[model samples]
Every structure is written in structure tokens, then in C-alpha cells.
Target: MTHATAPSPDAPLEASATIDGAEWWRSAVIYQIYPRSFADANGDGMGDLAGITSRLDALKQLGIDAIWLSPFFASPQKDAGYDVSDYCAVDPLFGTLEDFDTMADAAHARGIRVIVDLVPNNSSDQHEWFQEALAAAPGSPERARYIFRDGRGEHGEEAPNNWDSVFGGPAWTRTANADGSPDQWYLHLFDSSQPDFDWSNADVRRMFRDVLRFWLDRGVDGFRVDVAHGLVKADGLPDFTPPVGAGSMGGQAADEEPVTAPYWGQEGVHEIYREWNQVLAEYDGQRVLCAEAWVDPLEKMALWVRSDEMQQAFNFPYLETPWNGPALRTIIDKSLAAFSSVGAPSTWVLSNHDVVRHASRLALTAENPQGHGIGPETGDRPDRELGLRRARAASALMLALPGGAYIYQGEELGLPEAIDLPDEARQDPTWFRTSGERYGRDGCRVPIPWEADAPAYGFSETGASWLPQPEDWGPYARASQRGDADSTLELYSRALWLRSTHQLGLGAIEWHDAGDDSILWFSNGPITVVANTGVTDAVVPTPLRDATRILASSPHDEGALPADTTAWFLTP
Candidate 1:
């Protein structure tokens, strides 16, 4: 609760000597709670700030050092709170600003820090800034808050830039004049409702810094800057070249028109992040700034966390990599190398509000219909037990890594994807725009099941949830797993305890690729972790000979990891 006095601009900023301290995030476990779906305390079928505040003890019991709440800022919900209408106000649906203050005070009182998501690139059309920009009054300051242009003729028929929106479609949207003629074009890196701000403008930068200060003043710990890399773009808006093959580098098929090259990761982004970090450094301990950057190149990712920039940038490569042992090992090794090269602390995220759940991704295939079996020939079906084992395994591996680890809500419960949404029930904008090529994130966004027979699985009491709760999720609810000694919840608790009590997953990481598809091996000081991504059993070779049994496979055997199991050990 102690606030560091603001340092004078003439004084040197004291960079954190080490990631260790009251900045619990350094060696902490962050549980990401999508406020809308975490718990609906009002019984209105929507999760609110009060609901989250009520769950503080549960989170504390889970042993998470902090809770990264997805945006609850005032918005039209066009992008599910990502498009802010007012950075200083809380949305009515979530609760009032006073409610947020109550939540923050409660969380801090319980030794839990609260971090909220801040999407700087855009705001709702309802935002005062966007409204003023649209009006474009003479010499108005609001006009400078966003990127506004005269017309497409000044650039071209298409967007001045070849950048594609992350939500599918053009990054530029055409606006018409009062007379109905083409008047201007605005840049939107995600949705048209979320316009990109002109970071080049000093006023825009200052305004955003004030926004940050506003939240910090409200007693919130920090922010997770959404789409942090897309803040800046190629000024020229040059044409982009597509990859040679049909799919993206992440192994997903490309749907848009072929281009010569992508337009992300421009050099100007570094200065923008540096300035943000400088402003954030003015806060006290645990006042962190983390970036949600999706850039693949290690150098680009490093730019967001290069000491003078962000405290942490998400390591997304690990999220998309195949769950095979060798693939995971390569990712961990490469990530450590990259973070070390940049002299910044690393961060690992298994899942978030934006992506598919890890359990559903690793389990629930065509051959393995019920996700609980263990066999090389189980093929591809929903293997519940296997999924649970793998969930534990992924947690163990993540905790054993050298950096901070993020856990999406319900991941610890080994929750699977909701498979029964009718077409009309789908609400994800991505699925609507992409013609269902991608399954909507509704599966992961569904209501959190809290009990076996409680109405709507304890998410709400009166109405049905915005998204249907998965049938039979009762077994995975918190009430069901809380007392079970061998449940996935217990495993996660043990993993977190190990990380905090022994610092096994803290400090530096050294990785060794065992050159096998079935196993991923890495060491942090004396602690080592190995995960089996394949269905077949993998043997730990002599290179791992120094390992002593610290934690082993649970509800399954050691040598054979049952598709997605993980194990850990310590060396003398």
C-alpha cells in the first residue's frame, strides 16, 4: 500500500535491481479472470465487479499473486469492453468506479494485486474523443487523439497501409463527408469500432499517460496493454507480401488476399512503448506494465520489454506451438535465449481470453471422444482424464520455467471447450466475420461453472448465462474440486506453492532439447521439468540423470504421460 514518491524528471529513474521484491509478479502466478464470464454475482447472467470482489478469497485460496481482470471500462461492448468509451469510468454493467475501488481495496488487503486490461489502440465510437474527431471542429484537440486523414485518394482506393485487422478485414475504414462524398479514412487494427490512435502525436501520448495515471491513482496495481505492438504502424502504408504457402507462420491458414509482406513490427513502436514504460515507472512496487504483443520475431517481442520499455511482453509462440515434447522444448529454449539476449524478465502464458483453452486444444479430437483415457492408439477424441493430466502437466512445466506464468480462469479445473452452441447463439465477432472458418471463442468464454446442480452451474441464479454453460461441467466446478486431494486444483496449488516457497520456477532457465517428439525438458537452477506431448510413453535419458523426484505424474504413471502429462524433478 506504500506509494513511491514521484521522481523528478531531472533525477535518474531507478530501474528495478532485480525482479524479486514486493513486485510479487516477478515470481508470481497471474490468474486471468475474464470478468464477464468468471462469476455473475447479480444473477443477471453477467459477471460484474462486485462478483469478482466477492471471489477474492477463492483467488487467494488458489494462491495466485495477482488477478488480471479483463477490461471493465465503459464501452458499448462492441469488442467486449476492449473499445473504451471512457478510460476513467467503469461500465454500468460491470458496476461503478466506487465498486472497482472497493474491489481493489479488498484485493490488496488480501495480498492480491489487481491488474486491468488497457486497449490503447482504440475506443468506442461513443467515446468523446472519437466523437470530436468525427466532427473535426477547427483546431480541436480531440482530432489529434486519433489518426484522421482527408481521403483515400490521398493514399489509394484501399487502405494506405497493407496492415490487416486482427479481427479479419481491412484495417482502414472509409468515412464520408457531410455531403456523402468520400471524406476520410481511419485506421483500425482490430475492429472498426476500435480506431487506432496516432502515437506520433504528442497530445495523444500525453492523454494516454494521463489515463494510466488515473487508474494508478484509483489504487489498481497495473495494466496489461492490449495489442501493444499494433500501436504504431508503417507511416507509408506500404503493400504487404503474403507468405509463400497458404498458411500463416503460426500454422493457421490465411484467408485474406495474398500480399507481398506483412506490415507489423515497424521500428517506431519501440519509442512509443519506451515512453509508456517511463510513465509507468513513476508508480510504486508491483505497479507493472505488461504488453500483449503477438509479433513472432524475437527481436520484435524483446523490443516491448527492453528494460526501458515494458516490464513484460507475452511469449505467444509457446501458446500456438504443437504440444509435442520437442516442439515445446524448442519454444522454451528459444524464448529463454531471446529474453536473456534482451536483458529482460520473461513471461509465459498458456491461455488467455483471446485464445482457445489449452485443455480443449490438446484433448477432444475426432478419435478420442471421451477425454479421460490413456493409450497410444486412443486416436483423436475428447479424453477428459488425459486432458486433466495434461492440464496439470502444462501447469507444472509453466511453473518450472524461469519466468512468470499466466493462467486463464478455469484452466486449473481442467475445463474443456463448450461444444454445443447453436449458430444463432454465437456472439464472437471473429467468427461472424470469418464465415465460421474459426470456431468462435464462445467455448472458452462461457460462464464459469461453480457447482454441480446450482442453477446455470452457479454462474447465475435467475436467467441463463449470456453463453450456455457446458453440460456436465459440474464435475469440474470449484466446489467439486476444492476438497479433492488429488484433483487438478490441488496439483495447481502444489505447483504454485513450490514456485513461491522454494523458488523452483524462479531465477534463470537453461533448456536442453532431448531431440524427441514425446518429451520437453528444461531446468531452472536445481529444478527440472519434463512434459510429454505425445500419446506414447517417453523415457528420460541420461542427460537428465541429475534429476531427483520433486513432483511426478499424478493419476497416471511416470514413463508414460498419457498424451498430455507433465513431470518435474530437482537436482542436488
Candidate 2:
């Protein structure tokens, strides 16, 4: 059921009234919502479609053009909602099909477009097709829909290849016959519960096309293709050797590692996107397909966003770069040039459901690598104040860039990762698969805080949350930050308003020579952004020193830009 809320006095009446038509996505500011942690409407300790509907007003107030929801499709929740059992049905835990329609309607009424997560790389083992494949004979047509092959060793006891699951262990799992005798082995690039689909099968191709249409007909604006480069695999399923610095079996978390294995970024995947693009064209021209591909080399990554393929691919290199001015500038220039080659707009993102929040990450030195998670046992604790300062400055710089941007939920509140999550509460598959050698991603997935004093920080009605929120998050709650002029929330709100009014997304950047290695400056239309990543304060460039006006600044420095600060100025 839908649980609509009364609009706040400060909320915008229409979400995209200011957005340019047909090319809105070219420079739109999209917000990503991790459904289970966004809001809980039924007091079930889990967020549902109704909860998302009730919060549309808040999102409108935040000035986002659209919302990209993580998967809420029918699933066993083994690897969260990524392992889908049914593509066309909503998971009961997240509400019904009617609830999704209601939510979509509410968002549209506010002018906010909706984009859903699409996991086409694999399906849950419990899916009927996979079940059928398991029950059928070795060479039966039912088994052809999935990748099932004979084991290599005697008695069919060995795995087909040396590939490892991204979660851990062998990529292939053995199945048994009715009499408990070993039969064929199946390939699973992720967890054993997710069986890979055989794109070689015409049935698989047709099925996914129908899935895209199913959601498009129901009003979803587009899809954020998960693992967009993983649908195709190398022929003959050859053995893989881990590259230098690559984790064991060449399998590592997609967020931190560049996907370079034989199973990822194969040439055939572009053909899949070409076909999907044709499907999206049948709907609204404004509808988009974004790729979550972590492919390396900015040039190679650009292929996913070619004119005939996806509209945008996440800029992982930009996001993964360290908090240094020169490093960031190099990445920005390369990203812009790479996407320009394909005539597609680059997309920038700092945090997401898969990695640590930038608020904490910015404080850690490059010597201390960020692993799957951080907990009580973590040796290198983040310097909270420094992290938040750099995080806020980073946000200012990212927003001023000339392209589309994504804001992960809670980023506006300057919320840091829940670094102290108890080990018993860890739920990410990475943790269990590695036998707790890594803490996993549970820390960053904690629920957002709405009210400071309310139960579960006002995320749920019954004082319950799927992941425990940290006690110190009270001051960071939306209720506390909403009206504070100096708060991170206000900074984002004002920046976005300026971005829309000035058409900054569609603007082109003009680089400025800051004279200092630690200083970076660029002009986009009437706005000039200056960022200083050095330890000492730096003088504003000659042109910007006498600028017509100051639009915004992270630390609100005077006379000169402070260390680790980013400022936007208006030039005549």
C-alpha cells in the first residue's frame, strides 16, 4: 500500500520543471537509494516501495532529477536483491506490483523520473529456469538456458576451470543426480546461489528483452545495468591467471578492482547493449541506460557509452582517485576527453552502496588501503574532521563538473561510514565467504537517519532497522541538518539549485592555470570553481580574486581559499 506524506512547505511542486527535455539525462543529477536502508514505512525494519513513495517530497526538496533504486525484484535475499528469482515481479518483502506503480506515480507527479537496477548477468538458483536446468538431462534443452558443462577430472569431481567466484571459492559448483552421483558442474561468477545465464542461448536474449519492456511499460524511465560488462564470457571457458596486484583467482570486489579478467568486458557485451538501446528507443527518448561497468583504461570504458550503446557509465577511475589536486585534475581531463570521443556525457559519483562513504575515505592515507569494511579492529582510524572537510570540498568540486552526477543517500547529511559495526551483524557475502578475514560492506549500508531522537533515527516506525545505525549519528540526522545554513545538506541544496538555474550540466569546462601544483581551477559558463588540496592556504587566482560574486564555498574561507577547500565564484 502507498503511504503518501504531506508535502513540506519548502518542497518544490514539480521535480523536473527546470530540466531540459529530451536531453535531461545528459547532465541530470540522479540520487541512488538503497531501498532496504532508505526508509521503513510498515515498521518491518525493512524499507519498502511505500516508504520510498512517502519520501519523494524530500527528494524533490533536495533538487535531484531522478532516483535510481537498487533491486527490489523477487529474490531469496541471499546476495541481497541482486540474485533475482523473478524479473517481472516485485518482491513481497518490498511490497507488491501495485505499490511500485503507486511509487512511480508519486515520483512522476513530482517530476522525478525513476530508474531501476537491472541484474542481467545472472539469476538466482531458485529461478524456475535454473531449477528446470538442474532437473533435466545433461544435454536437454532446459539445461541449455544456463551454462552447464562436464567436470574435467575423473568421476566428474573437478571444476571446469580455475576461475573464482567474486564472493570467494570456486566459480563452478557440482550438482548431483537423483542417486547422489556427481553430474555436471555449473558456472557462477558471483555466488553459488546465482547461476549465470547463457547469452549464447537465443532464449536468454529474448527473455531479457521482454524484461526490459515489462518495466518500461510499467513506467520506469530506464535501467542502471549492474555489471554491464559481465554478460559475456570468453569462449571455451579457458583458465585465468590473476594479474599483478589482482586478488586470488583474479576475483575481487568490483568497486575497488578494475574488471580485467576474461569473464569481464568481453567484446560481445557491446552487442548486448546495442540491442538493449534499440528497446529503450521504442519508449521515451529521454529514457536512459547507465552502466555500472568497472572496466579499466578510460578509453576502453568509453566504449560502453558509445552513441549506440548506454548513455553513461560510472566513472570508476575518477571515483577511485586519491584526494590530490593533480591526480584529480588528470582524471577529470581524461574522463572528459574519453567520453567526448563517443559523444556521451561523463558521469561522476563519489559514494554508493558498494563502498565506504567518502566522508571517512578521504581521511585515510593512500598507504592505508580501504578494504571491504572497517570495524573496531581496524588499525587506521579516519580523522573525522579532516575527512568531512575534504568530503565537503570534493562534493563542491564534483557538482561544478560539466556532466551528470549521482548522490548516494545520506551524502547530503555528511554521514560517515558506521565503522564500528559488530562482527555478528555483518551481512555482506564478502565477509562470510572470506571467513571474516574482511569486514565487508555492512558499515556503509546502515540506514539513513531522518529524526535525531526517533527510534532507529526515524528510519522505521517500530524502532527497528535491518542494520544497526551508529549512536553518534543523531547530530547528522536530516531533522537537524535541514535548516542549518552551514550544514552539508544546505550546501548540496544550494549547489543543485544553482546548477539547474545556470544549466551547468550542459556547460563546457575551461581549465585555468592555478600556478600551484596543489591548486585546481576551472570555469564552466559563468561559474569558476577553485579547489586547494594542499596543507597550506592558497591565494585565489588573479581573475577569481576580483570575481563579481561568491556562489559557494566548502569551508567559507575569507581572503584566500583555505587548505582542502573548494569555492565557486561568478565571473563577469
Best by TM-score: 2
Off by over 4 Å in 2: 1-22, 247-259, 366-371, 548-553
lDDT of 1 by residue, 331-395 (tens): 77788788778876678887777655777666645321111122223344456666566667777
Candidate 2 is scored at a TM of 0.94
Error of 2 at 565 (Å): 0.8
Instruction: Name the 10 consecutive residues with the lowest summed lDDT in model 2.
Output: 1-10
TM-scores of the models, in the order given: 0.86, 0.94
The segments of candidate 1 whose C-alpha lies over 4 angstroms from its true place after superposition are 1-23, 137-142, 150-163, 244-263, 364-386, 510-517, 539-550, 557-563
The prediction achieving the highest lDDT against the true structure is 2
What are the Cα lDDT values of the candidates? Answer: 0.71, 0.85
- Extract clashing residue pairs from model 2: 15-110
lDDT of 2 by residue, 529-553 (tens): 8899999988778776567434445
